[model samples]
Target chain A: MAENILTPEEIIKRGELVFKKTKLMTDNELSYCPGCGHGVAHRITMEVIEELGLEEKTIGVAPVGCSVLAYEFMNVDMQEAAHGRAPAVATGIKRVYPDKTVFTYQGDGDLAAIGTAETLHACNRGENITIIFINNGIYGMTGGQMAPTTLPGMKSSTSPYGRDINMMGHPLKITELIAMLPGTVYVTRQAVHKPGLVRKAKKAIKKAFELQQENKGTTFVEIVSNCNSGWKMTPVDANNWLDKHMLDYYPLGDLKG
Target chain B: MEDVKLMKGNEAVAEAAIRAGVDAYFGYPITPQSEVIEYLMAEEPHKRTGMVVLQAESELAAINMVYGAAACGKKVMTSSSSPGISLKQEGISYIAGSELPCLIVDVVRGGPGLGTIQPSQADYFQMVKGGGHGDYRLIVLAPSTVQEMADFVELGFELAFKYRNPALILSDGVIGQMMEKVVLPPQKERLGDEEIDKRYGSWATTGKKNGRERNIITSLELKPERQEAHNLHLQAKYKEISEKEVRLEKINCENPDYLFVAYGSSARICQKAIQLAEEKGIKAGLLRPITLWPFPSKEINKLAEQVKGILVVEMSAGQMVEDVKLAVNGKVKVEHFGRFGGMVHSPDEVLEALETKIIGG
Candidate 1:
């Protein structure tokens, strides 16, 4: 029996490669934990920017969270904003460089809680920018603290007895709220736990950027992510839990366009 | 021919910003400084120089907006009164730590917390002592006249970019509201895209083009050693600025037995006080600080050796007085006197305070 063999260069020359990382991403390793949705979110966002050939004209604002150093991975001109101020910062950049594509990557705590005012006002003002929000139900960077998105009965470091609705306040469905704002031309929620879902989430992100280019208004894409390390569960268990619980609360699909 | 205009201090600063070629102005309305945004809005600078004038949601948003623009190497600025300035401290610290060049104008009003809408120098400590967190220094310029208010808009941007540091034009409600004759500088064109690329391309977050690496504007350094190194670099820059940037004016100091240390509106009041003292045969001199942070410490110390006593005048209870005392260092007796919480001290009151506080007491 004769076995056919091909060199790596020949495989690339023949365009037979299965997958290649986007050049818009840097060589630096992602700071997210294994199986964490942040890595996927970062990858897809970069892939979208690469697909649109906006690597040179894009400026990204990174919020204070596990991805505070998103600038380290996203190979583009970037600014790290004070906690929850990414929307306002992105607004500033977009207004000054109306021709440049500007976007912000923020987590729930940085977007829905401490930065709620900035986020809402930026959206309300119809800023021509995109906001990539990651909702993981818990504060991943600050060690599993209960976040504004923490579901009822969810256990976190701050909520040792599991979240009580009355005491901890009900989970915020901020995506739906943002969709209602006139400034937001497009708003959607999607997950990245499965291969099929990751593709859909990538589509949403790409669409958001496209709308931003249209100068329509604020474009928001929420990635319902899982934080296994902060959730104190195995990656598989976290995905299972997110699918069973987080999905019911933050159902996937576009709320506005 | 000089374009001379009789304008209010706030209006002069606004006009000066347009002529100085500021790229953008992000501000929110606040007492004592509301004219800044109002004037900019009415002038429609976008038509004049393509400047982006935005009314932000709040002072916090305004300052952060400035942070974003400055990171891109744009000449951005913001203005607010004391209470509003308090809200911007966090963003100000971030801008300082990131070492981005921008201007912040504080048309100061009285305040421990919204104390009054009237002029006060209570923010002297806040401006010169690094109001926000971290070890950082703002290049503070105290403008005593509307001309200086107009002049400092250009000068502030110059020093801010020269050192890649945040520069503050510390005015007061009095100067901001008072009308004065100002020779506005000629309109210089704003920096074009190619100019910005040529000038700040190395560090500014102006698109990662021309095959260069992505530029990041952040103050975070997780590594302790690296953070320390960044702090050391900032300190060195500040030290160099202090050595090269101390600005002050000496009036009637050729020989004097009594001296006054003041800045901003207080400096103007002290000038009048100087005239009154001379009439009373006191032979008083005035030392006015133009740059409050590089402070006129060395000069004040030299003068302390000549004068019998020194009195620091400010609208605050006594903020800059502490710095004056530090400069005098016990060589001569130093005293402080001022009307607090929106009250303006008259020339008669200032001379009387000099006689009673330093001379008689």
Candidate 2:
């Protein structure tokens, strides 16, 4: 039996690299849990910054969540903000260093719940910064508690009997709310569950950063992600469950630009 | 000499900050201290000296904005009243823990909760004792006059950068709203990015240029040993500050039977009380603390041996008196006098307190 396989040296000589990590990602191990989307979200963001050649001038604000330690992974000038204050901090950085590309990476709990004021005000003030919001429907960092983006009838540690709309209120569609603001020049909801969706998410992130470079007010990109551990599902099942439930409420694609 | 301008304490602080070449000012409009931002907005410091002045949504946002700018190695500041300052404690603590240099101005008003907007020295404990959680200290400076208000802005930033810690100008509504003749500092050009990189490049998060490692600005230390080490480092810095940064003004302390310890507007009142006491044949002296956190404890301790008693006059019920008693260490009689709820004590009232409490007792 003959195996038609090219050796590693032959493949290198042929200039074929199926996949490689971006240099903008540091060598530090990610602290995210297995089957979590935070790692993917972080990679795409750094990849976008690298693609834009903004590695030298990019400043990132890491929010308090699973991605709180994103500064350790993202190879750029990073500032860690108190829970949910990333947008306000980013506003400060962008205003003082207007020429630098500034962005904030935040989770649903940080952005939609605790940081609603900061997010809305920063957007309304037309601060020239990019906001990367990750929505996973539940708080994954501090146990699987209900989040502002948790869907009705979705069970969580805080809402064990399934979220009751009357008791828990409705899931907040903050991305849509942000799109309504005049200060937001661009707003989009994307995902990174699959290769195709990952490509789209990367494109959205790139566009957001580009808009910031043009000094064109706030550009918000929300990534509807999956928290497998929080949802008590395998990675594949979590993605499928997100497709079945989350996508309906938070459909992908551009809402504003 | 630069031109002298009759300006409010708050306005002087704004002018001094602009002339000091601060990179940015982020603030919310709070009474008594609103003039600082109002003046900066009207002056458009960005156009004059390339300083970025922004009216933040809240004091919470304002302080974090200062944190963001300061993390990038820029000279930044924020000003607020008591309630607003309370809201900024978290950010201030974070800045302290991270060892980022920034300036904060608290135009103190009466408080325990939404206290009156009148000038009060009630925040003395909060300013000097680290109101926020964790072990940290802000280089607190109390400006007694509008001149010191302007002068302390320069001094606050200098000390902030020198020690890589937050410095505060603990003014009151009286100082913030009152107008006086101030010789404004000469305008200094803002530092360019190159200068900032050259000076603070080792730790500042300016950018990852010159093949430098990415600078991370955060107060989070997950490891217990590392956190303890950071705490010890902070304590050492505070010790250095206490030893080297003690500032006070002594009047008649050389030979006096009674001493008055006061700060901010209260110091001015104490000065008048000293004269009134002298007219009554009571030799009284005043020790005004310019640096409240350092507390001038050593000076007060030295004066304790010479003076028969000490009286602390403030706008609050009694705060700084504790520090005075601690400094005296039971060597002499110590007492406190104040008027709260926006009340200003008269010179006669302070003299009466000294006569009734310290001298007579």
Candidate 3:
């Protein structure tokens, strides 16, 4: 049995290695909580940039959330923006460096709550930049507070009993809102929990970036993600909960691509 | 002879920015300064010099956009009025903290809140005393004329990049809207990526090329010790600016019984008041601070020795007078006289205040 199993060196020699980490990601360890989808989302984005050979020309805007430290992980020229200001910053960067590829990484709280104005306006203006929005339905970095995408009847730090739609209003379907904007050429909702879903999400991310080179307008790719620590659940349980519940409201597919 | 054009202060600024090789202009339409963006849109700077001019959703977006472009080692600017400037303060503070170079033109209107569209210098304190949060300073240049409006665009950018700090052109409605003869500077080419890399390669986030570490533009320092060290570095930069960039104009300071301290449009009024005071057999002088942040404190201290009294005139309710008082240190009498809420003081009123408040008192 020991002789039958191929050694690590023999596997490399046989070219059986199907996957490896992209060079576009730095060697620094991620600071995101274990089981958080942000790590997956970040890795996919860097892989897309690396595969597209855009590492030298890509400029990323990291928002004020758990993903705020994305600049430390994504090995690209990065500018960290104030909470909810990533889209405006990306607009500025793209406008000045028209030939460079620009994108913004924002969270549900940053994109749908504090940054709604920036998100809507930048998309409305047809800024030729990609926006990767992570919708975890809760504020992970701020200790599981209620977010704009938090589901109804969902319990959070702020909503201990459950989210009250009558009082707090309904969860905002921001990707749907973005899809309606004339400036947005492509808008999609994706997820990356399972291997199949991860592959699909990566394809969507690649399409969004490829569209950017065409100068079509704003391309928005939202990854419906999970926050195990925020939800007070194990990583495996969080993915199961997301599959059973989050998919009901945020059905993943292309909205306008 | 150089080409001269009779242009409004705001238009002159827009034209000067285009000629100065600005990479982008992001702004919103605000009273007293809408022409800055309008003229740029009309002139189509992109067609002229491949410059990017965008009308931002609000002043908040405009300034953040400036921060973004400035981070990439590009020359960018934004213009807004008093209330709009207040909205921009957060972004301005971030730019200062990040040590990015950019320009901000605050064509100030009268304000406590939505005050008036007419010119007022009430924002003097806000601009000079770090309008935004945090330990930082903006290199404030008060442009007194349409000519200065155009000239300061070039000078402001130069100083901003030299120190890697934000430079503000503080103009009131008078200078922003008034028409005057301005000798427009010759157009300069926008710097290419190669030139930017040569000049700002050490810091600017112009992409991680040439095997260098990825450049990150941010104001966040989580560590308390590191944050304190950053604040100290900013304080040192401001101190160096104060020592070398104090700018002011002294007229008839050779011999004077009294002096009028003013800036921007108020300085022009003081010039007339000085002549009127001379005609009344009273020797008066004017000291106009061109750079408001550095404040010309030392020059004011020296002038206090020769003049019996000093009257600080402004369109606001005497904001800069405090700076003058701080500099004078009670060696001579320092008084403030002004008309508030968009009111402009006439030469006669300023002269009367000087005689009664400073000379006679």
lDDT of 3 at B323: 94
True contacts kept of each: 0.76, 0.72, 0.74
Ranking by DockQ: 1, 2, 3
Task: Sort all candidates by lDDT, best to worst.
Answer: 1, 3, 2
lDDT of each: 0.94, 0.92, 0.94
**Residue B168 miss distance in model 3 (angstroms):** 0.4
Candidate 2 collision pairs: none
Q: How well does candidate 2 score on lDDT at residue B100? A: 93
Alpha-carbon RMSD of each model = 2.2, 1.9, 1.9
Which candidate, 1 or 2, has the higher lDDT? Answer: 1
DockQ of 3: 0.80
The residue pairs in collision within model 1 are none
Candidate 1's residue-wise lDDT over A73-146, tens digit each? 99999999999999989988888899899999999999999999999999999999999999999999989999
What are the per-model DockQ values? 0.82, 0.81, 0.80
Between candidates 1 and 2, the DockQ winner: 1
TM-score of chain B of each: 0.99, 0.99, 0.99
Instruction: Report the C-alpha lDDT of model 2 over B1-361, residue by residue, as the tens digit.
Output: 6679999999999999999999999999988799999999999998999999998898889999999999999999999999999999999999999999999999999877987888898998888899999989999999999999999988999999999999999999999999999999899999999999999999888779867899999999889999999899999988998899889899888899999999999999999988888888999999999998888988899999998999999999998999999999999999999998788999999999998998788
Which docking category, incorrect, acceptable, medium or high, applies to candidate 2? high
Local accuracy of candidate 3 as per-residue lDDT tens digits, A137-199: 999988999999999999999999999999999999999999999999999999999999999
